[model samples]
Target chain A: MSFVSYLLNGISLGSVYAIIALGYTMVYGIAKMLNFAHGDVIMIGSYVAFVAINSMGLPIPVAILLSVAACTLLGVTIERVAYKPLRHASKLAVLITAIGASYFLQNVALLIFGANTKSFSSVVKMQPIQLAGGQLNITGETIVTVAACIVIMICLMAFMKYSKAGHAMLAVSEDGGAAQLMGINVNGTIALTFAIGSALAAIAGVLLCSAYPSLTPYTGAMPGIKAFVAAVFGGIGSIPGAFIGGILLGVIEILGKAYISSQLADAIVFAVLIIVLVVKPTGLLGKQIQEKV
Target chain B: MKKLSKTTKSSLITYGIVVFAYIFCEIFMRTGHMSSLLKGILVPLCVYVVLAVSLNLTVGILGELSLGHAGFMCVGAFASAVFSKCMMETITVPTLRFALALLVGVVCAGVCGVLIGIPVLRLRGDYLAIVTLAFGEIIKNLVNVIYLGVDSNGFHVSMKDAMSLQMEPDGLVIIKGAQGITGAPTDSNFTIGVVLVLITLVVVTNLVHSRTGRAIMAIRDNRIAAESIGINITKYKILAFSISAALAGAAGVLYAHNLSTLTALPKNFGYNMSIMILVFVVLGGIGSIRGSMIAAVVLTLLPELLRSLNEYRMLIYAVVLIATMIFTWSPSAIGFRERYSPAKLFHKREKGVQ
Candidate 1:
């Protein structure tokens, strides 16, 4: 029963990671660049939601909507101002620029929010569920988080499969030049990807804060990196890969903390990633491309 | 002197600059012209220069992005600090102890580099970058949990807390888990730092212009072509990475020795530091050794320079970072430079003279 509870907790945590990883994987796939700022966008989302609820006296759902809208706009703006100029530049340049953007966002947040850690009020109002004569209790945040993750994942998959914009995204990811030649607006598609990814980031931010209930300028950094690892673990360019990778990573992290030394949990998780990458360089779901002479 | 080669001339200038800076700083200190703040940053400035230059070896010359350079530095720092602590009484001479500790730090970091590189180098591009990042975090996380003590019955280590070490009554705890090592001798100084910086510059600059350096660059330019031309890709990659790691380790030694308490904080040894070093390399101009040194010094000092603006310091720094990237790499900026470059004007003046 305790193991079952741990697994549930892992899934809930993993669900948040998956949501963030989805943003990372999508941006990487479409733009062929890592948006290091994507993590900070999550931080911004949380802050926005926090302000909306606490200061503005807005309802939870309204605050969430506002956060999502703000993040989407911010993502598109970041893409245009910081990233678009580096489209034809080297991957390294784009990465550095993304990093710069990340620092910019973090500093801005720091200046506005100060360095204090805010105890976030949970947005989820659902009642806790008890099982096995109340020995195992699952919090409302966990249920909402897991449910939100699954719903988001399913909707993303279906949208990518059927929507026109999604097909354009697929085409761009496949080959930007070819897609451009085929009359697809590669830039537009990339922006849309950013918009959608940022929206998901906002949701992930809310869920993350609700579960962990702490907010800071750096709240998203570690989780962002972990989700990125998850994205790579499952297979970088694949959607389903991010899901499986996030869940597995979360489970490993939780179980490692439970069974092994909690202090070494992060080490154990990273070590496993190294081993997995050694076994499969492209990642579990990542496609292998032959070198061209 | 008879006309020196371009590489030779550049290398000479680089050495000249370091020596000149050291002499300049020493004179300032003697004349009481340097501020306490500037004086304090002198050693750390050297450390950053070394880090920036060493990381340039991998990111600039070798063309592989490593996000775990700080992990190597952490390994180097903790190894040296541990050694220094354990030998505090046994080793009577500070100089000898410090040198041995330095060697231990370098060797440990280099070995870790090789171990990490062997498996990690198998992956390419972003995959390789991510793996390095993972290794770096792993190193930091593991270091945070480590508990080490030394007594009459040799050394004892435990991943648990300090109490779990079960050392003898007279045992001294060198490392107390998250609390980290305290009381390590401060054997580092601005002079030693500058010397190490010079040493690192010589090694890295020489490697960049050597036959192996050419081979490494060739691999970076075109891996397939280099492999076809009989270049040992795996060997060179590992060699460059490990050497770079060793240099970073040396920087870590300087860093560790300068402080009384040495802890592997994320701010110091995490991916952020690695990224900061990378920023130096990129902003300086990738593959340009002198540029890296200059960039490291300027960027490290910039925040201090902007201390008056306190709240806006990092904000301005970020803006500068973004602006520099755009200026350096954006297509319009490149075109603008080509159109109005000083080199082109100089060439035109020579043509007119002819």
Candidate 2:
């Protein structure tokens, strides 16, 4: 029964990672750049949601909508101000700029919120579900997080499959020059991708805070890096891959903590990533790109 | 020959800068004009310079982005500290002991670099960067759990705890898990650090201009072309990476010896530290050795110089970082620079005279 409970908890945690990893994969797929600032955007979104719900006394859904809108605008603004001008710059230059933007966001949060950690009140008000005569328990946050992850994943897949904007995104990701030649708005598609990714990040931030019940400026950084690891684990630029990788990574992390020394759990997770990459260089589902002379 | 080659002139200028800085510092200290705070950072400044120059060999010269430089530094620091701690009694001569400790640090880190690079360098671009990041995290995590001790019955190692080590009653714990190693000999000073910096500059700059350096750069420019030309890609990559790792290890030795307690904290030896070093490399202009050295010194001193601003320090740093990146890399900024560059102006004046 305890083992069953641990697995459930792992899946719940994994769902949060999946949500974050989806943002990373989408951005990387279209832009071909690792928006290192994406994690800090999660921090900003959570703070916005925190302010809206606690200070303004708004409804949870309304707070979430406000947070999403703020993050979407921020995402587009960052892309235009910091990233768009560097479209033809070296990859490292773009990466460093993204890092600078991340530092800027974190510093801003520090100044505004101070260095103290906020105790996030759980937005999920429902009671935990007891199964097998209360031997196993699942919290409402867990159920909501997992269900939200699944719905988002499905919606995203359907969007890419059917929507006109989604088709433009697919075309842009496939080949930016060719897509532009075919009358697709390359820059607009990329901006839409960032907007969508940042909006998902806001939701992920809320769910993450509700589950953890703590909010700090640095909260998103470690998880962000782990989600990036998950993104690469499943196969970067692949949507379904991020989901599977996130779940597997989350499960492995929790199980490692339970069965092995908790201190070694992080090492074990990274080691597994290394082994996976060594055996499958491109990743579990990453397409092998051939070099053209 | 009446004139020096371009590379030689540049190398001479780099060496001249370091010598001039050393002489200036010496004069300031002698005249009682140096602050305690500024004096304290002299050794660390050298450490950063060595780290920046070495990482440039990989990221700049070899054109591979490595996020594990700090991991190698952690390995070197811990290895050298442990060596110094165990031999504190037996090695009566501090200089010889410190030299041997430096050797141990360099070897351990270099070996780990080779071991990691063999598997990691096979991947390219983002995959390679992520793998290095993973390896770095693994190193930090593993070091946090390690427990080591020395006693009359030799050394005892355990992952569980001090009790599990099962050392004799008189055993001395050198490494106390997360507490890390303590009481290592403080045998480093500003002079030794500067000397090491000079050595590193010589080795790295010489390597960058050598045949092997050219081969590495060729691989960086075009791997397929280099491979077609019969250059051994794997060998040069590993060689350059390991050498860079070894120099970072040397910096770690200087860093460890200058401090009383050596702990593997994330701020000192984690992803952030690696990125900080990379920032030095990138901001200095990738592949520009002289620029990396100057950038490391200036950036390290910037925060200290801005101590009056306190709260706004990091914010200003972030803004400056973004502004510098834009100035250096943005298309319009580059065009603006070239249009009014000093060299271009000098050439125009010469053309007018002609």
Candidate 3:
């Protein structure tokens, strides 16, 4: 592939990665917990779509929206079931619970979906959008995924910046105790954060199906890890950074695969992480917060 | 004061019991009546015991929630497998080749352990979890591309090839490939495995009970306080990690030699295996060596005891894990309620270091 085409593939992947990264960053910002199960939540989102499109025979758009809704509810339910009870526990306790939640979700998926891989129909276009003298053949799915992610991110940014509920979320993320004292419903905002993050994850899941039709219980593992790298690269709590990092990481990964050995691509991404730590530990686009003693 | 002395004396005697246990295994393996199949079970139990315990060294005693302990094991497994191959191939003297191969494997895995440790030791929370997860994937992928020295498929020789190289005129040595490293000289019977496990147990027990171990535990409890109190948190983290990695490497060496297989199947050692060993740590209670030991044995044997249960084995394991977490790791484990709320537990410990 030529350089322009390489960059284009990178951006297409980057957009999907950015959407997923937002989920990790937002939950981390609010809960200060890694939500190890978030990757599994993405898994749940994919399966939700599988049931909708494959089993229920719903229209593609309806299936996509239902998957997002189901995941949003599931995300909220996870908080109430797993996290709420551990609100005052040690980091290790909560951490383990998150892992437990992850395993629980995966095992349940296995039981429900079986160990076999689920095939999916394109939520977007199966046809490629040919452009620029056959140099660029963007898939209809890629364009929709990129456009949808950009829109959701913009709306999230606007809500956090301007909307009363969104600002309440900001307060809770900044200082849960203080936010509580100021009469904000900290629990509700936290739930809202999970719900929104899960919905976003659902969108990424749908996009993944459009891109790669085979879905397995373990399918979320790679994408989740990559988006997490994006969240860290951009700065864990910085929304804009998550977007920038996610997309940039996707591009680098693809380009690295094309130009360099695929074996070294992962290494190169992590090498970027190691270098970033030496240069700016808080991440690129992230504000440095002082460690509280 | 009395409790400390008794505990110390009991732990010291635990080593004696471990040595005795190995001797018993030696006798059992040599006895004419015992089946090789039984020896297989006993021997693998020893190696896996070391693996689970060494991993517990990081996940349990050190209190670092690493999700890549198996990656360290892979390093150990591959290093040993590759070494055994080179020695058998390069050296004409069969005995010399065997010894060198095992030696090279252990050392290479030890080095790999240290290399992966540097960037990750200071990381905390789920970043460590995710990074280790990434590290595991990277290792698994790297193994896939190693070309295992050729075969009928091509130039990748596997554990199968290495095993075939080990020969005995008296008909003692045996080897096999993905068929499962069949002829490995069968040197890795129960006694050797048990002896290695004992050595690992001793090293890990000593390390966790040392001052460095205390520092690790302290760091896990309160990072800022431990650092302020002059604990070199990062140093101890790396120290624990490297040592634990070395121990897991040792186990992998024992596993390959005993099984007599040179197969490089990354699929076997995965995130689930890491999680399974971690379940041993948590089910037994983290920060407790005795807990790790007891949990390792039970977790290892539980699947065997459930042979009749078969497919339900994983389901049972999953259920047991979920229940354990709900019972022990959850805030509700202490019976938190809406009337008092979970946050009250914090106020009670507010004067204490977080």
Candidate 4:
């Protein structure tokens, strides 16, 4: 493939990462905890969509809707059942609980799904767009994924900036105690944050499954981790930073696969993160945090 | 003279584990009713014990969360495997070679620890966790691409295909990229694994009680205060981390030697394995050595014990993990622990004095 095609592939992949990273950054920003189960949420979303389309014989659009709704509910339920009780617990405890929830979700999927990889039908059906007199080609799936990501990013930014619920989320993220004192329901705002994040994970999961064409109980794990790295790379709590980091990481990963060793692409991606973090602990766009004595 | 003392608590627990493990193995061996499946898990159980205890040093004692422990294990496994493969012809005796391989594995893992510690020890909290996670992934992937061969001319290492090794026609391939080291002597057994576990427990417990161990704990409890008190934070951090890595490597050697065919996979030495060890550390209660040992053995054996559950085994394990975390850390549970602490038995004597 030509360099442009490789770059295009990277862009498409990066958009997916950006979408997933948004969920991670948003939840981390508000809840002050890494939702380790976020990836498994994506897995659950894909399974839901798969079941809606193939098993229930639903249309593509309705399948997407059902998947998103299921994910939102799952996200809210997890936060209530697993996370809420540990609200005042140690950081280590909260983190372990998140890991446990992650394993719980994955294992539940494994038991139900039997550790098999299911083929997913693409929701977007269109011919490949040929470029440079058929020397290069790009799938319609790529175009839709990239465009959808851009649209979602813009909508998210606008919602955070203008909407009342968005304002409440921001307030809670800034200071939960202060937000509670100001008549905002802190738990409700946090729950809404999870809902939105889970919905976004669903979108990312669908696009990822469509592009990859195979769905398994663990399909969401690697992408979830990479997106998290992107969020951290751009700045863990910054939405715009997550967007930028996700794209950059995708581009670098694809380019490395093309030019360098394809097998070592993951190592390169992580090495870059280690270097960037060593140089800037808060990430590129993250604000400086001062630890109080 | 028959009465228990405060210091004896740790030794009692330590000796208890060793003695109990010995008796358990003896009973299982002597009895014909025990399943072969349960017998096979003994070595793995001991390996997990060492892993959990070593990981506790970094997570519990040093107060830093490292998610790349499996990387150290991977390093040790490959290092020992390669060393044994190279010395196959030179060392005719299996026992001597296994002992030498263990040393090589421990030292190599320790070196890797120091190397990773230098860059990683600077970061704190979640960032440290992520970096170590990245390191673990990198090591696993790197192992996938590595090609090592042995021949009359000595060792040959390459990243490409076996042909790239450029060895003589009869050269033996040690690590064939993804196919890992093959034909390495399977010298590990329950007895050796138990010895390693005992060594790990003794070393970690001693370090926890020693002055250096206290300094490490101080760093964990409060880094700023530890530094204020003129503690060499870097020295202690590296020391604890390296020691942890070395022990993990020892466990890896045991693991590598036990299996006939060893390959580096995500399920084996990847993120999943790292998280599994961390589960043991966290569930056991941080800073509690005996707690880690008990947690490791129980968690390792839980699935085996629930063999009848079949497919539902992992699901049950997950629930147990979630439940354990919630119970151990929740505030209400704190009340239960305070009231029912093991020291409560001595409360009657204290009440008489009062």
Native contacts kept, each candidate:
0.84, 0.74, 0.22, 0.68
How many angstroms is residue A286 displaced in model 1 relative to the true structure, after the best TM-score fit? Answer: 0.8
Which of the numbered candidates is closest to the native, going by highest DockQ?
Answer: 1
- Residue by residue across B183-281, what tens digits does model 3's lDDT show? 343345555666677777788887877888888888878888998999987788888888888877777777676655555454556666676667677
Better of 1 and 3 by TM-score: 1
Q: Give the residue spans of candidate 3 off by over 4 A.
A: B1-4, B13-44, B59-63, B88-103, B122-124, B147-186, B214-235, B258-266, B307-312, B336-354
Per-residue alpha-carbon lDDT of candidate 2 for residues B10-87, written as tens digits (9 for 90 to 100): 999999999999999999999999999999999999999999999999999999999888999999999999999988
Candidate 1 CAPRI grade: high
**How are the candidates ranked when ordered by lDDT, highest leading?**
1, 2, 4, 3
Return the TM-score for candidate 1, rounded to 2 decimals. 0.97
- For model 2, residues A249-277, the per-residue Cα lDDT tens digits are 88989999998979888888899999999
Interface RMSD of each: 0.9, 0.8, 3.1, 1.3
After superposition, the stretches of candidate 2 with alpha carbons farther than 4 Å from their true spots are B1-3, B340-354
Return the lDDT, model 4, position A44. 96
| Model 3 DockQ vs. reference | 0.28
Model 2 chain A — which ten-residue stretch has the worst lDDT? A117-126
**lDDT value, candidate 3, whole model:** 0.73
Q: After superposition, how far is residue B198 of candidate 3 from its true place, in Å?
A: 1.7
**Candidate 2 residue pairs that clash:** none
